[model samples]
Target: MLLGSPTVTREAAVWRRRLGGNPFTVAPYALSCRAAFRAHRGSFDARWRRLQQLAPLLSSTAAEEGGSLRFVPEAPTCCQAHVYLRGDAAALDAARDAVLRERGVRVYSRLRGAAVGPEADECYFELTLGPRHLEVADAVYVGAWRAFFAALAGPQPGGRKGVGDAEPQS
Candidate 1:
């Protein structure tokens, strides 16, 4: 199913028509099958292990600040975790911006449109434990995530209401 907004989907369709077809159908020929398999296997294993180790810590950190972690039924096999904060889209965007500007860490705030499913318009951040993250210390990542949530839970400056003032959106 298409996951983007109508405009994005339309643009993609136009581009696809202009390009003759979808470009992702072709597989890269840079690696042999055996080499590709080995590389993917190693990366997958590392990511899985990192996910297992970080999920709980990140969840607990969120919990400490009025946030919670939402995992799908296939969370065990998934490489990403979703953290729901007590706020609206604007609050989430503000927190994300603050975290990036202050901590120099990038955090994603997902806003799924109606096309995705019933969970559309939900305010949450997606965190993934990938191969690149495998090398970083767990404490470092968790600290940044914690700070992000804290920013959401705290009061905003300049007389702006913070995320803590808003009701949690499902």
Candidate 2:
């Protein structure tokens, strides 16, 4: 399902924990996404760096890297766990038929706006779908990210950043 390799699979696990499904299948997709990276970078360290970039993008709800990485701050909708796979993107008619059916998701909505990712394999990039980081994260996820990053980097600014009430953008 993923266009990329194996370790990037953390992406799928985060989703599976949030989405709740057979993580084994999701694990394979994660490997595939990593494999896609292999196709692009032609090396392992570079691809691993790519995964690390994405790792920070996600807010781990549980321990990771042997509890080295803490969960980053997350938005309400983000932590709520929404995931799905649209089997058919070519379908244009009002009633679209799924070429493949995925289980345990409430709805499959089209994600608009170009999301940036390493230009590895193209097809598998679609597997990278996720909701937008919300305004709520300003109150929560950023704090979590800072804490987690600090925990890994040795504490410097521990909860010193003030999250002033910024108007929620629609």
TM-score against truth, every candidate: 0.60, 0.18
Give one clash count per candidate, in the order shown: 0, 15
Per-residue alpha-carbon lDDT of candidate 2 for residues 32-140, written as tens digits (9 for 90 to 100):
8887756644444443433344444443421331122211222221222222212122221111112112111212244221212222211111122223322123324
Q: Which candidate leads the pack in lDDT?
A: 1
| Candidate 1 ranges with C-alpha deviation above 4 Å | 1-40, 81-86, 109-121, 124-126, 156-170
Error of 2 at 31 (Å): 1.7
User: Model 1, 1-170: lDDT tens per residue?
Assistant: 35799999999889866886553542343235557557666687678767777667766777776774554422446666554444567767777777777778876646442223235544555666656777888777777777677677677556533444564589
- Alpha carbon lDDT at 71, candidate 1: 46
Cα lDDT of candidate 1 equals 0.64
